[model samples]
Target: MMRYLIALMCFFTLQNVYADMTLTIMDQDNKPVSDAVILLSKESVSTPDAVAIMDQIDESFVPRVLAIQKGQYVNFPNSDDIRHHVYSFSKPKAFEIKLYKGSEIPPIAFDKPGLVVLGCNIHDDMIGYIIVADNSYVIKTDKDGKASLPVKQGDIVTLWSERFIEGVNTTKEINITNDTEQTLSLELLPPIEIMDHSMGYGFGKKQW
Candidate 1:
C-alpha cells in the first residue's frame, strides 16, 4: 500500500507539470475575435470527461459559440420559463431535443468532427454553434482573443475560427515546448451577413 500511495502521488505531480503555453489570435484590421477554438495535438486526444453547456436564456443561447472534443456531449438547458425544441441540421452530427421546459434529458453527444449549427424549431431567431474538434486538448479564446493552457511539450497545436474556411486557416501547426508563448495573428474576412445575427458577447478583453 505504501508503494501504491507513492506512485499515485508521483502521477499527480507529473500531471500538474504540463507545459504552459499562451496563444493570442487576431483578425484583419487588428481586432480581437472571441470564441475561436485552439487545439493542441500531435495525435488525436480523447477526452471523455469534456462536456459543454449551450444554455438558453431570454430567447437566445447563453453561449453562442462552443468548442468541444469529438465524442464529447453537450447539454442545452432552458433557464427561461418557456419550453424549447432545439435541433441541429449540420451534417457532422444531427439530432433533436424534443420540446422540454428544462434540461430533463441527457445531453447530446457529438461523435464526429464538424461544425454543428444549432437552431430551434419553435423559435426561428434562436441559433447556436457547437464546433466539434478532432482532439481533446481544446480551449476557446476569450474576449481578448487569447487562450492559455498547460499543454504537453512537443504537442502540435492549431487555431481555428468560424470566420475562415476549415481547410486553409486551420491547417497551420505550431509545436509546443516547456514554456512556449506565442501570439498567432490571423487576418479574417470582413464581417459577413451571418455575423449580424450572431450572439455577440465579448468576455474579458483587457488592455495589454
Candidate 2:
C-alpha cells in the first residue's frame, strides 16, 4: 500500500511539469543572439542537487558557457599541462582561484544566483561565463539561436546577456500553460573590439 501511494505521487509530479516554452532572441540588427541566459523564478524554487564542470583545455575555457542552480557546486578543472588561474569580477559572484593545475582544488559553491565572468589572469584571451540561477529553469541558447525549457505558468521570466548595454530591457514576464513559442527583440551594447588571436593558451611550447 505504501509503494502504491508513492507511485501515484510521482506520476502527478511529472504531469505538472508539462509547461514548456520555446524561446527565440534577436539582437539589435535582428540577428539571432547566442549565449543568452534565460532565468525563471517561481514563488517556491526547488532544484535537484547538481554539479557542473568548466574545463580548461587548449588554453581556453571549453564550452565557453555553463548554467547551474543557486547553491550548487561547480568544478573548474585544468585539462592542459600548465597552470591556470580562474577568476571573475562580475558583481553577482566575485571570486578568484589561485594558479593551479588539475582538479586538486575543491569545487566552488556558487551560493548567490548571478552571472560569473571567468578569466585567466595569466592568459588574457581565455574567458568564460557561469550563470548561477536561483531557479532550476535555466538554459542558454544554442548556436543556432533556439532553446526550449519546461517552466510552470505564472513564473517570472528574466533574460540576461554579457552584451547588454547599461540601459536596456533585460527582463520580461512569461506565462505558459501549454507548449508555447516566443520571439523577442533585445537591444545590446556595441560589440567589443576584437583582441589578439595569437595569445598563448598555456598549451604552446613556451614551457612554462
Candidate 3:
C-alpha cells in the first residue's frame, strides 16, 4: 500500500511539471553561456506586449546580440549623441537606416526567420547581431545561463549562440520528455578568437 501511494505521487509530480519546466545551458567548458536563445519547434504569431529595442551607445551596440520572434519590430535608437548609419545585408532582412542620431529612427519589422548581422557604415568597429525565430519563445539564457521553458512531451527545443565553436555544430535541437532530469548541461564549443582589427581605419575594410 505504501509503495502504491509513492508511485501515484510520482505520476502526479510529472503532470504538474508540464508548465514549470526549467533548463540550464552550459558550454563544453562547463561554464555558463550568455545570450543563448531557446526556441520551440512549434511556431506562434502572437507578439509580446513590449517592443524590442537595440540601442547604439559608446560606439557599440549596447546588447551586442538580440533575439526576437518573426513579425516583431525592433527599434534602433542612437544614444551615443552621435550620428550612425546602421544597415544589414543579411538574406533574411536587408535594409539600412541612414545617418541619424537620437531615437528618431523608425522601428524595423522583421518578418523572416534567420540571422541578421548589423553594421555601421561610418564606424568600422561597430557590429551587432540579431536572430529572428518563428515564435514568441521566452527561453533565452540569462547571465547565469538559467532559463525557464514551459515544455511538453515530444517538444523540440532549439538552441543557438554566437559564441559557439567554429567548424562544429553551432545550433542544437533537444527532445523533451517527462522523465527528463531536472538539469540539462549542454556541450557547446567555445568561441573562435579573431584578430583585433575593429579599430583599423581606412578603405577596403571588411564589410558585413
lDDT of 2 by residue, 34-129 (tens): 777877664345654766778787777865768888888888878688889899888877888899997777888888876778999999999788
The sequence of per-residue lDDT tens digits that candidate 3 reaches over residues 1-208 is 9999999999998776566566677777778777777887564547655668887766777567788878889988876667899999998899999999877677889988878889999999888888888765645787777777777666778877776654222577877664343445665666433333345321223323
- Model 1: runs farther than 4 Å from truth? 1-18, 149-156, 165-179, 189-208
Our model 3 lands, by Cα RMSD against the true structure, at: 7.9
How do all models score by TM-score?
0.67, 0.70, 0.74
Computed on alpha carbons, the lDDT of every model, listed in order, comes to 0.72, 0.72, 0.73
Residue 40 lDDT in candidate 3: 72
- Please give the lDDT score at residue 26 for candidate 1: 80
Residues 1-208, model 1: lDDT tens digits: 9999999999987765664667777886788777777776544567569567887766777677788888888877776678889898778988898888766668888889867888899899987778778875678888798889777566667766767745422445666554556666676766323332134322121212
Error of 1 at 123 (Å): 3.2
How big is the positional error of residue 134 in model 1, measured in Å on the Cα after superposition? 3.1
Ranking by TM-score: 3, 2, 1
